[model samples]
Target: MRRKVMRTLAEARPDGLDPVPGGVRAPGRRRGSGWVAMVAVAVVVAAVVTVPRLWMDGRETTATAAGTLDVAAEAARRQVPLPEGNYWSVTTLISAEESAGRYRVTVTSKTERFLPRDPAGFQLLAMTGLHTRPLTAKDAAAWRAAGSPRLCGDDTDCENDVSPVGRHRYTAMPSLWPLDDSGLTLPLSRLVELPVEPAALRERLLALWPAYQERMKDWPPAPKGAALPTRDTWLWSLSLDLLATPVSGGTRAALYQMLEDLPGVRGLGRVTDAGGRPGAAIAMGGEQLVVSEETGQVLARQDAAASGRVVNAVLFQGAKWVGKLPRLPKGCPKVPVRDTDCVG
Candidate 1:
């Protein structure tokens, strides 16, 4: 009777199930096969998602290492070459934003071999209209024949003085746009190779300062109760200490310290480039100090609130030295001021 009952159960199979010849599988066991397949699909999906994140992380690491290596190489390549005792005429444009309209100032400097015989040694011959038209050849010739004096007769020779003919021309007109007031100009000779200490550089500057001062002794002084001429003579002396200070990693901490050490300077800050290379900014007599980050040079500087404004802007270029200085040609006369000795 038991055998007959088992045969009857086997003959009546469940839905979607086929009886095996010698084995039996429960319905739950078939469902478990589906679960296993789902698990495999989930694992494959997780692996696909994780692989991209790991690849991106590795790429970012590689990029970071490459950037660091590039920066190091650039720093190493930027070796300061000893400057040849050559001459450079520099013109800088300075503009500042104040409550009043923009103030624009142009400063022109002639830096030649500090020859005793050359009257243009380390001097600013002109500080006037920078954007004005350059002098015509005929007019320049006349201006040179007239001894290249400050004024050709009564007319102010702005062209000849700012844009002098022959060897005294500038190599490029460096613009001080978005004026930072703390910019400085330094001679290439002032930059020393790295690994040299700031103290040593300071000594060299001090040793050379006496001569520099002596050379500038004869420069016309700013008149009492008048604006000081922010020319090379004055600007050079003001930034000499900063220029002399050695820098590490393009940041001149020692120079900033020296500037703060000055009598009137109250505070100092560091200027940095886009890449975080450090520089210096000084506060003097209640004004913001801005310096050029590219060359570690100073450009134009000004005093802050309740104090008078001083601006110096210039541009520089290089040219072949023409024989004999050019003369000023006839042109418009400078606007005269009564009881005031200031010449444009």
Candidate 2:
């Protein structure tokens, strides 16, 4: 789903407008040359959420029963040493919930992106695996009681099959780096150049609003005349997106500090991410980010509905600069060119 990042630029825009859409596209990029996007689903049930044990220097320190964790300090302690490599590789597990007749199912996917250091070098994407299952055990039981009918019977066969569960893999085409969007854009190489100071980063991000607003007018499906969001909303959304990016640990810390200063940003106590990792949840402008209490890494970002149901989430698994791209598994579908659309 990372490819959907470019499909809609209104990510986390206020007023409950669905920010990200389906599928990401790069200008002049060929079809199936997977692009990354920023949308997934979060299953955050507060009642079952528990305060996590604090970790210090790789040791268990104390249990924070209060459920409150110092986000900025933890972020500052994050030690993501930039690896010596020729490509920036990012991996994420994305999940989203969709209605299936009377029941809802959660679809999850694992994606890896390899952006070459040289701008002209080919960028690779791989959807390592995907799975769709009932949103909860209750839903599964209900589906079974209903005889496990395929929701899209005779249509597309409902992702995998209609029953227990299954995982699917797909091959992706290679693409070029430096996203070609009409609005604000940041090339892979520029990620390291981001300001590490909170104030300066705020100023830097604010400078892009005019261009972003101008471009939104041309974004397809936008009404002839529609009001754009305020600077606060835009900044909040951008910060969220950038946090999930391969920004430096220092920059990520600065972002956490910036979010702390932003209005309406508040702690949501402890919450578990889609990956079952406990994190300190923070909320701002109708969106939530679950951050690691120890490493300060962004564990997940959630968009919830009015009823407090997490509709979508994007979970950060790991990211680093690598010396080379991952090799395609044996028996992958190969195209005529260098890249292959091989499913693993």
Candidate 3:
């Protein structure tokens, strides 16, 4: 299930690794925080897996879905055109997590390998997840006085004397986001297959929203008048996922179409990103997103502050699909399927 963002994005993810391990933690295992190292890795699947969607509530939502469809229809009707070329886009996904008056920055650069057998599934390869502790004069002085000496997780050069003393390092993790496409799954492939037509996409999204909502148990069900559980956040979450995942141009465009319905999301016109490239812009939930006018790919998302500091940012360095998995490391230990040894 997805977690809360920082009331901000980290409000979305504390360690920003909820899609993988439970929580980001200090190097070396904690006694009882349920910290895990590697998540489930992917192996080639030749046949198409037909799995039934599992609903945690177990109650049917066909009627409730009708309400969702109405929301989608409204969203679909208002979409503005934004086109993006089809190709695999490699990205450097970066986030600065705030805690205890310090920002723990995590940088992860990865290229995705789209599986033909599983159009919706992609293998994240050449992955690099690193953490940096940039300290201020006061913070450095405090750590130094505290004996700036503890070594960081494996890399000695990385001194453990950092401000936010509890951040973890996730490196070279090769795994699926939802872990797999099994029972009660997120319907990523199914959603991808839905025609780019906004109305059609909305239909499919509502069909899947119940299952998707089950996964987001961290948030309560939409009450009489709660904010995020509204149609906007529901569709916004799906649209955000598609933009971040390795999907098709049709899918990208369809989401932008639905996004047009979000009254909360305001287009800020053209803007340049931190990387100095021009793209269209929009804002929601105190976060602004700069999307490529051509590809519909999200360039960056940051706080709504005038300074516009980034909460999370992504730069699509490159993109394209490959026929086969990139490769495995030489003699990479083949742990048991359920083993927790693989370092992500």
Find the candidate with the highest TM-score and give its number. Answer: 2
Off by over 4 Å in 3: 1-90, 97-116, 119-126, 129-192, 211-228, 245-247, 301-307, 333-344
Better of 2 and 3 by lDDT: 2
Tens-place lDDT per residue, model 2, 191-213, is 76889888998898878878877
For candidate 3, the TM-score is 0.53
Q: Cα RMSD for candidate 1? A: 34.3
lDDT of 2 at 188: 63
Q: Order candidates by TM-score, high to low.
A: 2, 3, 1
Against the true structure, candidate 1 has what lDDT? 0.30
| lDDT value, residue 173 of candidate 2 | 30
State the displacement of the C-alpha of residue 118, model 2, in Å, after optimal TM-score superposition: 2.0
Point out the higher-scoring one by TM-score: 2 or 3: 2
Q: RMSD in angstroms, all models?
A: 34.3, 11.8, 11.7
Distance from true position, residue 116, model 1, in Å? Answer: 11
